[model samples]
Target: MDRKQIINDPQTGNKGEAFEAYDDIPANPNLQRTIGDVIAARYGRRELLKGILGVSATTALFGATALSAPRPSAAAVSPEQGRYNFAELQWGNDETHHVADGYDADILLRWGDPITADAPEFDVMNQSAEAQLKQFGYNNDYVGFVPLNEEGSRGLLCVNHEYTNEEVMFPGLGRQDRADFAGMTRELVDTEMAAHGGSVVEIARGNDGKWQVVRDGKMNRRISPLHTEMTIDGPAAGHPRMQTSADPTGTRVIGTLNNCAGGMTPWGTWLMAEENFHGYFWTDKLDEDGKPDLSEQPEAEQMKRYGAPGRWYAWGKYHDRFNIDKEPNELNRFGWVVEVDPRNPDATPVKHTALGRFRHEGAETTVSSSGRLVVYMGDDARFDYQYKYVSDGVVSEDPAANARLLSEGTLYVARFDEDGSLTWLPLVHGEGPLTAENGFASQADVLIDTRLAADALGATPMDRPEDAQPRGDGTAYVMLTNNTRREADQVDAANPRAESSFGHIIEIKEAGGDHAATHGHWSILVKCGDPALAEVGAEWNPETSENGWFGSPDNCAFDAEGRLWVSTDQGSGWGKTGKSDGLYGVETEGELRGHSKLFFRCPVGGELCGPYFTPDNETLFLAVQHPGTDGTKALKGFERASTFEDPATRWPDFDPKMPPRPSVVVVTRQGGGKIAV
Candidate 1:
């Protein structure tokens, strides 16, 4: 299920759903058999001559029956705790990009911090695109800086603003319509569009060794959907599937959406993910001339599947263009990893169509030990696929070569065997399992519409997969955000838990932990749950083994010591025990499979996101989002803007009455000691 499907309170998780599903296949042979029988047995009267056909493809990807016993280790633990203080706000709001040995470089920009003179200076009360484009912009998410000097002196900061808090960014939501009937009025739509993407700013260190945003810096630019242009690459480029009135040739599309936590290529580029693009499309039918659109279309179902756009947001007016029912191919342009070369702002951002897209959380890239470029990406929706694209064209560390390599590649969707081994199956045309009738017209179609292509190819359905990060060696870690709709019958060897409450972290090794192996090994390294809180979701029912809960795992990062720092999205209502959201640094090594120590806790209403480690591993930066998100009360009832008290979750010092403030936090030791060993 995608993010739109809400799980209400106190419902018996995944119980109301049917035992058999059109999309999912149960792992139990008996259940599969029963499902087949039930379909035939119940539909006997449908037709005298027709017979029911069972699932045509149910190959067992999981081999060896079960995963080996859990092997906990301390070597895998995160160094976040030992190195940095939990509650310190390092250098923040300086209007300048500066870095020092000790922490002080937290909250770098404000909502209206000017990027150029044309962009106005900070004034929260009144804001505009003219000012925004020129200013530091709002709500910075993922921050990646590439050091210009070997001594780590200067670099570039690439940050994404997931979305805007319109109320806070605009004056009284100004005449905007949030109605879903007609997707959105142009005015209202423009406002939302402006807030969707990221920014690439040039930063340099002064004689004092401090980094500052150099206005008019040669490479400084803002890449937003409202104005940024992108080029199509790999499989789906120029395909009929992506054709729209906007770009009838199907070769270009405007802007990327909800660009979140991403990775920097070893070859010197940034891989920004399109997280919630589905939210923008409206599904109602209407022609370009505003006439009644035809109902019969080749991609009607596909349009329905991707949120049936035109659904309104928090505001109340409507424009109908987002309706994909009228324009089925429009929605196809999103969900792919868009690559940006910060060095060349004018270079069209390349949508690496080879990597399948589905609520793309982020991507991690590494030149495998064999020296091939392997891009690992996840479809954030529950039950989506984990994909890796290996360029048919070999890799080179040369910046120019790497930029051209991702444009052409062999994409593979992963399948986990029961024996703990995983295989990256071919997702190209004329290859194994991908044929014309199976909905894959060609390799390009399979790559562009990867979710459907993976389903056709029998790719393993995973819990919400977000941010796949590769460790120093070849092992990769993924944050499997919890899935509350899974049932006992759905639990397979790899997934292990049904209706898991606390999401888990998955560890994947390419064969011998080689970054470039076509085949690999996989296992759940850690399951989130409070050891003392007792079991939260539905019990294992005696027959099913108890898979304890940790909370939901979001983005993750590795320090110089090879430890895993996990951020959380546990503040959502789906969490068990209603625990306060926080960040955890796990130290995994011998005998420490899931030892998660609380590293830093966001304010009560905040969620910790974007855990990025500087290249030197000297600093850990995190984004604290929506410190007072529960600000639904009337303005009269609204206390001062920083109302994060009443429910204390003080990270560093643990105070109760402190006002909630969302900012980036940099952690370092007081006396220069390694953090979190």
Candidate 2:
């Protein structure tokens, strides 16, 4: 294969399908604007009035009058009600996790930590599939802390192990090379598979207010891709497209793959998103006769648009189930949202198809005024559309009844309008262009080919939509992670930057404060960039103040007081500058509205993720993924080899002799008070 072809192909490149249509459209001279011009034209008038009144006009229109009230300037919180105090930290590229000055942080869990008695202690040079199955998986992404007792001292810490950094996971597997395929072994492949799911570990807060994992606790369990069984539910469960030779019923799968950012449901189940799972399979593997068997696949074009490059990992060589040419339907069974009840270890995890399927980032849910359950989700691929699933029935107090609600909801794709308004285009069968004549034969077909249906309906394509978080005040915020492939003509009011190296966050006010509302109004909350740079800076000019600017916002969450907290995933551009990926907090309301401050920074080459807060808003838990993943680039004398001999980063363990390992970090105030206060 030509490296240039792979580099230029939207499906095979770093931009993924988000830039699939970039070359097809020409640049629009009128759409091009300098950073200052764009910021002034977009927020000048609105922010002027907001600055004077200390509240957005839109917030007033929505009747959130409390947001306009005057408040203290210090970082103080009421014990009864969780509120955030503003504090700023300077950015640095140190090989350690940095937190606010008054706050203290410590590593809570690291990859390969033994969760059960059967699991062996972590041995970097001698890891096995069986050992990994009983331990914490690799690359923890989303973190959810669910209290088991009323005092909140005991709880279940649920985390999603997104994907493995193969080079770092195995002992001698340096940078990935085609020649290394000849030396791949079953043990290596199995170990990789065992590290791709989620983990539920029992945790207890000590008298000192620090959290620790309880080894061999009753709730401690690892849901790995090696042995866990998952049930397929919803309208598409028994569809022929999901059937496979291994499971003729088409209603069961062996495991979950690429479990990324996730959320905790109101009923207390973990909703994990299966993202970038396609890269694990080998679709174009050669047959016994040395001929490509994936040439005739019916959904070849569709698969390409979903970023299925021929044989990236070639796991098919070790496992027949991963060979798409041999079992095409197996790929279809992996992209849905899988829900797990941490309280019941024996409960069967489920993949809810009613939410529809793509490269799901996760599902953030809120109940509508009418009592219907509404779930907001994002398709993490570039140029993909944002979606939401609105349950047809009302939520119930019974957990069993609530579990069935997601299996019977309507999935809709978003279409942002030019006038700062957006409409949810329902992807229901027999609706508008989604009919048999257009190839959608049933509801399952519509759900299976969700992206195609959305494209046919002319839904607006967005920069990689990462996380959609809803606030208690009836508005939701969606992050459009930077789209480096966006052209001038592709520029829209919502995504104003052409080659958007730095992304923006959009605030959506659901119509009538209803989560189930089909029509909503939206506005760009912040156009993220370096405030010191004149080309793509924050509108408020944060560079002059303690509040520094950031880019490529990935995972986000709202604090107890409804403040927006953002974490960045800076791609290949890491380490070129002095800045490392970090977590930042911004005031969404009151006198400090529109102000952003850097709260914490990850180590070199690490992306900050899973910024979840405790119910009391005292402790903040976050995941630092892929630290020192310089990958052959010798930046600051750090080489990208994954072997323990020539490791790039020795994080968590600051020893210069050890290799870097991804881990979850917990942050809290040193004086036993609320965080950020």
Candidate 3:
């Protein structure tokens, strides 16, 4: 199918899924060698790791040079042995979410739920933009906790509301993007803007060990794209390209949008990573096929590289700033990590420009062994690059002093080699190819057009890298989500499968156990898919059950004990796996390495996200987004578009008057002890 046909197809459920199809065309320009060619050239140790990727895949991902290095300290001698002790939950598609046998998954917050004491109760029929600004935002993706007390019983919850699902989120409005957005009005667009960005609320554990929102708490606040004002900091803060008519200073911008996976800094700050910002931009001009027309745009080349003026939302049609024809530089102000202080509501959020702009999936931070702050990031596109930002200043006990770490960091892109060695190429202006001749006139210019600069630096193009989590031991895990659009001649060693359905994970051990190091060793942790299919090249521990294996590893985290937990988001493609998206605990060390077990499962059409565990490991928080709308066409009996008035399931509340609201679920043990001990 053609690009326009794929996005306009009848099977396309929502604009988000349509955007995924729209992004099938990669932004990277260099694709000389495919994965098949590399695998065909080298053919050693292909049998040893058959336990993982099978013989169909060669030793390109797990070469001897990297595998021969010392394994993790917790390595086990057998696949059946590991530290996790919970009974695996069987996976299946259903209308309601499911958890393990010994856990209680309770709904803590839902879309439009009243979060402030003065906020009115949610009335779906009478929804208004003014009301949504005070209530819980829609489609929560990232869940973070900041402790407010010594016992860790009381804390502030920071959550990111990714995007709105108009089909299931509104009353009479059907799919708008396919209908030329005729149904989208100014009020609806304003409500969607109010729903974007992040939320901060105070919570406390009761005597019964249940967490409840403190509606009247002093820290309760909402950060929305409609009205939230943010300050820009770092090298590219005051660049000419960042200036707009409304903001001549070029150091301030209004609100954050498309806030996806985020992180909690060591000094108690929330890092909101912006993804898919290009989709929110609007363009009045369209070609004969109704696609964005950028022929006469001044910054057409730079905007096309990032897929700007995506027309995913109608906000730009109603608001001048979002309209690219009027303010071309407004698009550049976004796509960076915004740091927010959860403890203080009045503090203005800062967009750290030192962390290069891209479709950032996650901004997970960890203090290096030498005390410098290191943030592991992934650009979530088909052939985008993974990045790292190392702070020049060391972290100290003072919380205020650590706040500047992100603003003064050196950004580097990864270059994974076939020899299993990884190199971090610095994206420094006036260094190497990043000079005046290559379009980088200054450091600010390099930071403004990060993707263009990285392309010149010879960075390795990855297969949809998303949500990288770095542990205290300087070991980082990267989730390479599947890239089905990959053709036969476009594959590489890191991404071995052409037309890859099931994605894989890469384990990186930083050089000298330092996250800020310039070098590292990378090995394939697991090639995720059904182990029963050898043609799929899936590698799993013999102990993995039918329900243990999963696909499209999206967001991931490490528990207090250093165990890796992954959440999947297959969208409409979940039909291929015949299982609902959920949370899985995969063993990364010792004998049980590559073994996976299902812990929690989402309802049909819902994507699991933000699997966060408390410091005590007693409470696990998960975000179930866009329930009952994603891929309902693949559902066995319900084979049609689900509207807000006629959803497949009324989850959480299950009330006939309510729709399937996106919610945040809190999972706790039955008897109130450390989980899965």
Candidate 4:
């Protein structure tokens, strides 16, 4: 697939085609755009300042002294104070990770790093599927560090290998050559499959405070597309839609693909979201009868709305499971949150279907006031709805009991009102439009066609909702990544920008400070873009300062002190403004509220993901994915050449002659006290 072309196309880029396909369907009249409009108009200016600053004296509060001086003590200050005290890093095109002045960063692990004793060392020239399965996979995105001891000396580092950059993975192939899928070798396809999934490696902090992977640790494991048993659980499990020849019972799946932004469960498990799983399947090809098989499928329209393509990676040529024509039900088995227990290497990972299937960015959980587990998720596509799953059972003290919490839940899609309030529309079978008359025969059917159900409920379409995270203070923050295809008619108070190229962050304060609140109030945290392009009547001001402005906010996290940290994924827009993708810190409260600062910049053509902070707030971990991807340009014909002898970014290796490797980086204050203090 030509990723660059896909991102550039206004109609098809970032799931635009899917949104258009579902746009004509009438939304529920009760959930129309009136509420969003009223909310935006009423709070456009007044609430914008108050929501962020929490005080009236904005100018006096955010004066030079606040930006220049050290923060007050934790007890005397707000959560944002002292968390982002570092100087903002400047924008640069360098092929290296740049951090703040008082901090140091180093590569902790890279693509192909050995995770087990039997795994061979990384050798770019002699790579194989067997080797990749025993090593770290490609494109690390969501990262979760689970501590094993109170001292924080040893921990399990769980990283999601979102997808592979095939052009860079192969020795001779480039983007242009990737179009000739028929000419590609099966071994190459297998290798690519081996590189897609997640990794679990034990890492330890040395006495010197640097972190390194424990190669021989018993907990070290790699779950890839090549070989892994994932049990399907919840409403959709055992349904006819999920049954395949390989799994006639419909209770098992081969592996998880395109695992993206993820979260750690309270029960000590990793929930990896299968984002863009549709790109791995080819559905529109001819069947044995020489007819377009996708057109004959009962769920064809649903597949189209989910962004199923005619021919994508062409993995079907190498594996029958990836060919929808041969195994039509295989695609239905994916696109759910797969749970993996990193602490137990022998455990069988599970695909939780109660969360409802969509283009999931990932799942973040927060305990509701009622003691139920509230799982927040975003379908990572333009115009997709944000969803939440509330467990019917209360969280249990026993890990065994808590593990089953996600299996039974009520899935709800969000509807933002004009008065800045949000409602969770139930996507249950027999509920409103989701009746048997509308093709939903059971709860499983409703969960399987979650997007359709949400659309039927008139859920507010968002600007590519990516990561939804809850803070310790009961409010959750969601990153609305850029959506260039959104039109003026689709704009609402919640999604104010018609063509949201730069994106924004939204703050959701759950009603009664409960994560499972069916109703909530929301506010725009920041309208992220170059301020010079700000339009009239904008609800919030665009980012103005050179030190703060950024675009395409993707992964996010809250520090121990409650400050928000964000990372940018600048797809094809890399280096467009001479600014590279970076990690940023924003003050959500206190005198410096609404102030954002760039903390670290990624290498050329790279995205900064998995911005996780340790419990002690002493270390920050980030994933730099797909550096040097822009080295080659697409050509008219299926032919191209590498821009240089090696990849454009040598990054952590710091060698121009070596291929750029995506790696996990750790940052800490040089003086060894708590970070940012």
Candidate 5:
């Protein structure tokens, strides 16, 4: 796999798809007795039965019950079998979204839709940063709700605008990254910048049980990289490395970008995680090979470790800070979880550096049995480590004191052992490998170069960890999306597969029923892929229907009933499986423990994200991102890159003038009942 060649070619894959595929290629070459090596030794490998998988070794890891019986047909499971009681939604690629039989998937908000009261109507032909700041941003990923009332009838929806599809965003600016951003102007780049953060809008339930955007909602606001000012907090707050030309003080910075999967604090604060922040940076200085020229950078080693100055977008062409050659430290400002008070529009969002900077996929927070705030996070990169932050202080009735919790915490990276035990290695400044001897001078340095410090400590590198959801019973589910780059010798007990393309889920049971516990027991919940293909080594419950089995499990949510629902982001790789990215109900316990059922699916070329269920569980908000853009070339009829002019499907609004817009969909059971009941 020649990544450099693939990246240099403009006609290969679309801009975002090509970059993501390249990024998935493992960057870390420092594996010694890492997770995969430990797993193969711990599990005792057997001879490969077929070219695709090791049957005996796989069964040993996922339990003999996984393959006790042949997989049932797609419609074999009955509704009364497990906790999830919805009829499975048939899986396939299509122009429109679909849900289970008794539910209604309503479009609540679309990109460029007016979010504030005085915002102008969406006009695709005439877009400006000014208008975008007042409207909904593009490619919504994370959807979190902060209730305004006790019944949760009214709440603020905090939706993250992950990124923009330049090919489908502008009318004539067909892919710009590969062309050296020749078609992008200052205004167009500004608009893209304005659409990169998160949107906070108040929504209410009407008499008909449908969720509607409250246009006049007092707290409606947009946070964007264009102009929104933010402050740095925690140990790395005012570090010298964070000081940039624009903000010499180092305490202040511009808005956040690439805000992906996030979580809501118990006190009503929204935590937006900056994932893949490296891709937005740009640099004109290229070597003879046409790769980013980082030879002049002072922090070249650190920059390469974190994948900075990727030049995926043209933002740095217009903004000096995004260019590594001009302002190298600016890349360090992002990749931390930014906490925002959605209730107060005047509140300045703070980037908590104590969380330890990396490609933070999700900041799912929960209160430990001891009352301390425990946040489960994934690095969201192949061969990266999973991390958790335990606050020093416990929660109280006062929201102000709880806000201080994030600023002062001990961050730890996971190290899964062959003994089926998980150890949380503290990343404190003076601890273990995170000391002055290993380039970490202060706590700030450890937090800033978190990946480097974790590398020194020999943290277990799992397969693209993303969106870990911790349960109330002190159990945490860590999602290993996929890592086809992993070899047979690298397989570990935590991730028991080599060249695992379909990915798997690992359930962590915190010791002593305390999430803040430094140790726990870990096991593979399920190995994701097609159970029908024995070589693929899928390990779903035999009852998992053909439509139920899924791949590339990215984001997951535990509903009010404690049932696990997963959403996938297969990206351009969705072509591997004929099924479109969708949401599925997965059983975590009982006789039907590993059973899964399809609940909802996204439109063609779209990825399912933010499957957030309301407090009452009556409604589920699903964000369909990058619709009609990814993998369109794989679709039989549409064998080309999708643009605004030639989209695979103009979903939500089939209007001839409107392109397929990423939207937030509200799902409710017909006749007003709990979803999937």
Candidate 6:
């Protein structure tokens, strides 16, 4: 998620220079922001005929070759390049493996064990601050599981620790800024708010059957964003720009940020997604008025387009309302969609606020047999806007009233319709051009300036949705992640490339298959560049763009006999030069054709997150964040800055000199067949 550069330089514009040392990343190197040609020259082109009435009502019933399928069977990537040739193998320092020889039994859950009965154990040298907020925390991103019925038999799991690791979960090695604000005397802000939000735990399966992590179960918990409560749902719940005084009806808000890639809700409940909740607030500029101004406010360009800066992580002096002009509703209580119920562990982790707050990166769902739910979200940054919320409370398949219909919903906003289709649009509360004459004066200002009211209700500015998944035949699959600010005359027809830099996945469909359809029928269905170019067939003229395609395409899923794992995110022009990050599994059905290789790399200071699968498709979890964090200055035991080390990936099969732990691995399938294919 680093291509942000909006820096007018307030100390490298908040948390930039990746917390110091040999900095050099935020090179805004300006001249990029054309806000897409002043948003398509002030929105002037219209007719997408609801994308030709949703591709003439589903291309005469699925004629569209089930939207291009039949591309697999190329030996689905030689057993992951003959078991891990993408490097980053160290297993001793707790855990790390970009997959070693096609799986079948692998485990690592470290960083304190317990899981609840009031968790708290792993020490890493003295660690505390209320026992790292009831333990089992520290690096572990997006893991999902629910099962418990329909023959799936029993589950709960949930994970998501997307941040934190001051020299391996604290107790010093090199430390940064060193404030120690006493959020209970900083065990580094209690291991950065107990490893940034997420953990439901409760699992169970073992006795050599796999699954594990139920330590003391009873629906284990831990929702921290510094103590979790989170309520606020839909059209900015009680908006006065999300009022407060501890929620005097700004609709409750307190916890969750950077909780990355999530989903799961058909009445069981989970849905987390608060990606980069704007680098945890810190904008002070003396606002309670002793006098200071700092240009831009009337919601500073809509809270800096959802990376809110009523202040953001001013880490140096430590805490004191991490200064958002002294709490402008604490960065409007973090980019929404929180949910969580994992079978009620005292259930109170909300913030659905009709899913508008941006920078989210996850939310998928699908319901309706006349209960109308359909969620699907993603706003991972660069070029943003791809949402869906649809729920004015209709859920009645009764899982206790469909977990209170995700606190009532309606939010929409998506528009791409030239030939391909899609049209949701409704950010409700007085719909259609929402009010105060379009500048939206209500519905909590169209869900907190939802990308400037999806740009006065036109929506469709993609190339950065980052994970939606769905296709068991209802179609969804989004991802997008690359848009080097699309130049070459701003390109359009729903982001037709300009300065693409590799990224595109789309798919859509909706309408009668109804994910509570407002409209749908998109295509492109896959167009990630780099196949040893040749103008990549006139910029993906009409589909086919596969062969080990590279560059930015971040978080994706679809494993249970569906195949399509693609992960990769880091920018710069795609191989018209350098830059490379890995992970890919493309086989979108049959004969295993569309084979794209490069299965796992990350390690040079990683990035390949949330790749779940286990629903009997046999295990395979994976999260491995920031290994030897390549910013240096945090080294120890064998010059730490880890790679896990020794006889390659043995990873916490019981320690080998700790310090490389960002744990969470379970892969499976050895002789079980059908995995890593």
**lDDT for every model?**
0.56, 0.73, 0.85, 0.74, 0.87, 0.58
Q: Could you say which candidate leads in TM-score? A: 5
Could you give candidate 4's per-residue lDDT for residues 1-677 as a string of tens digits? 23334433433322222222232222222334532343346445344323332233223334434334553222333233445676667666665779978899889999989999899988877778989999999989999989999988789999999887665666666542224365457777888888989999999988888888899999998898889988999999999999999999999999999888989987778999998887788654555532235666777877777766435465888789988877978888888999999989889999999998988997998888898998889988776778999999888788877988999879999888766688999998987989989888999989888888887788877777899999755799889877665456545445555555677788899998988889998876776766444351222222224656678889899888777888987665543455788988876764455567778998776789998989999989999988766412221221122232456556778665557788999998886867676
| lDDT per residue (tens digit) for residues 345-453 in model 1 | 6788888787775677778787777777788788776566678877766676566677767876777877766555778877778675577877777877677666666
Clashes of each: 63, 4, 7, 5, 6, 28
- Per-residue accuracy of model 3 over 141-258 as CA lDDT, tens digit each: 9999998998999999999999999988888888888777899889999999998898899999999999999999888989999999999999998899999999998999999999
For each candidate, give its TM-score against the true structure.
0.76, 0.87, 0.95, 0.88, 0.97, 0.32
lDDT of 5 by residue, 95-181 (tens): 889998988999999999999989999999999999999999999999999889999999999999999998888897787766778
**Best of the candidates, lDDT:** 5
lDDT of 2 by residue, 1-677 (tens): 24334334423212211122332221112223222233334444344222211345334322243354433333332222223454567777766788878888899999888988777888877889889988888889999989999888889999999877665566666434334255568888888888879899998889998989899789889897779999999989989999999999999999898888988988999999987776676755545542234568887755655555335454787777888768878878877899999999999899998988788887888889998988889987656778999999888898768978889879998877655577899999998999999989999988877778887777766767889998866799898877766655544334555667777777788899998999998766666775445555343322214335677788999876667898987655553335788888755554344446778998876788899988888888999977766322434665433354555567988665457888999998887877765
TM-score: the better of candidates 1 and 4? 4
- The alpha-carbon RMSD values of the candidates against the true structure, listed in the order shown, are 10.0, 5.9, 3.8, 5.7, 2.0, 23.5
Using lDDT, rank the candidates from best to worst.
Answer: 5, 3, 4, 2, 6, 1
Better of 1 and 3 by TM-score: 3
TM-score of model number 2: 0.87
Name model 1 segments beyond 4 Å from true: 1-105, 137-139, 167-188, 204-216, 285-297, 310-321, 488-494, 537-550, 574-580, 630-663, 671-677
Clashing pairs in 2: 18-382, 18-383, 75-85, 75-677
Between candidates 3 and 6, the TM-score winner: 3
TM-score of 4: 0.88
- Candidate 1 displacement at residue 473 in angstroms: 2.8
Q: Residue 164 CA error for candidate 6 (Å)?
A: 18
Query: In lDDT terms, how accurate is model 6?
Result: 0.58
Model 1, poorest ten-residue lDDT window?
Answer: 14-23
Candidate 6: tens digits of C-alpha lDDT, residues 1-677? 22222222222211222332111122112223222332232222221111111343333323354345453333333344332222222221112444545454355475566677766567656666577666666667677888766645357778777666454444333333232222223445545776678887766656565667767778777787777877776556776767756666787766786787888876667888877765666554534331224364566656555544422233423554455555566566677778888888887877876677777788877765466677888776666678877676776756766665766667787776555556788877567677878678777777766777776666656666777877645677787766655556555334445666666676777877777778877664445665345443112211222334555677777777666777765521222323334566654433233334555544434455678776776666666555444322221233233222322222343355455555666666555544654
